[model samples]
Target: MSWLGVQNLGSRKFTCGHCGNIVASSAGYTRNGSNQRIYICSHCGQPTHFDVNYQYPDIAPGNDVQHLPEDIEGLYKEARNCVAASSYTGSVLISRKLLMNIAVREGAEEGKPFIYYVTYLADKGYVPPNGRGWVDHIRKKGNEATHEIASMSKSDAEELIAFLEMLMKFIYEFPNKIPC
Candidate 1:
């Protein structure tokens, strides 16, 4: 079995709403319509009310799944590492991949626009807010350049590189803010 994913075990260290003791939590998915867990506090007995949303999945055995951190970092590196060997299309794909990763890493909701994540990061001082619009615009242009073979020019490549470089810097410095 391959490594499907991994999450912070006991990631949420919240105080027990019942007993005042610090609750050590372990997150897991439900099986057979029943929440599966054994939460035993020193004072309170086994509290097995593992809510659906609160339960985080462990590294299950499967394919087509990936841990967010590694995936995000990998995509960012790929975008930055691509040299002249990559066609404009490849560069565009790499850039989009990085943006998508950033969205996921930032925990952006599904179906959320990628620009929202960019703007969120910018708001948090990770990136300049005004720059997100420009970067996103260029990302679209890069996509067009990739699609139209004759449209890609050295000037386009240079512009894409500038955006990519800025993106890479943000990812490296503010990894926690970007999505995977």
Candidate 2:
């Protein structure tokens, strides 16, 4: 029941449902067949489609806060994939192992190529070496599991996922600093 199908309202614009950004039509129009408006955001091209009747009020520009909801979603998928792939290798321990590898791979030359990733962030002044406690225990278990000393259990995998959720949040909040 709203005729505010227009994307840009001079000082206002429609917010994208996909990325939550104000959308402005880039040569887009309302179709007669469906009457749905189709357009892309001036920032992210996340094809926004919505009912033409939807009304939007005068809204101000976003504060430009960095958003990582999609990134977290991706990490969740990646964590699931990592869990699935490493289940046989170390189960939930894989999450811990990945964290350690991420750290070691970033820097801590006492390790190995881990410094490559860490150096980039270090140079950017974002590598704080914080919250790395999970590495020690997980690495210990992972090493044992990999060498056939023991096998990681389902509980271990679940714990790893929980741990990963924290890491994912870190990356979401400070993506450039975290370096995946």
Top lDDT model: 1
Model 2, position 149: C-alpha lDDT score? 57
Stretches of candidate 2 above 4 Å error? 1-79, 82-90, 104-132, 174-180
Per-candidate Cα RMSD to the true structure, in Å, reads 17.3, 13.0
Every model's TM-score: 0.44, 0.37
Per-residue lDDT of model 1, residues 1-180, tens digit only: 222222333544544434445666654322344544334443464343344434211111111113336776565444433423334455556666566566556665656665665666666554555676756766576567556665454445546556655654555545655678
Q: What do the candidate models score in CA lDDT, each in turn?
A: 0.50, 0.48
Clashes of each: 8, 8
Q: Give the TM-score of candidate 2.
A: 0.37
Best by TM-score: 1
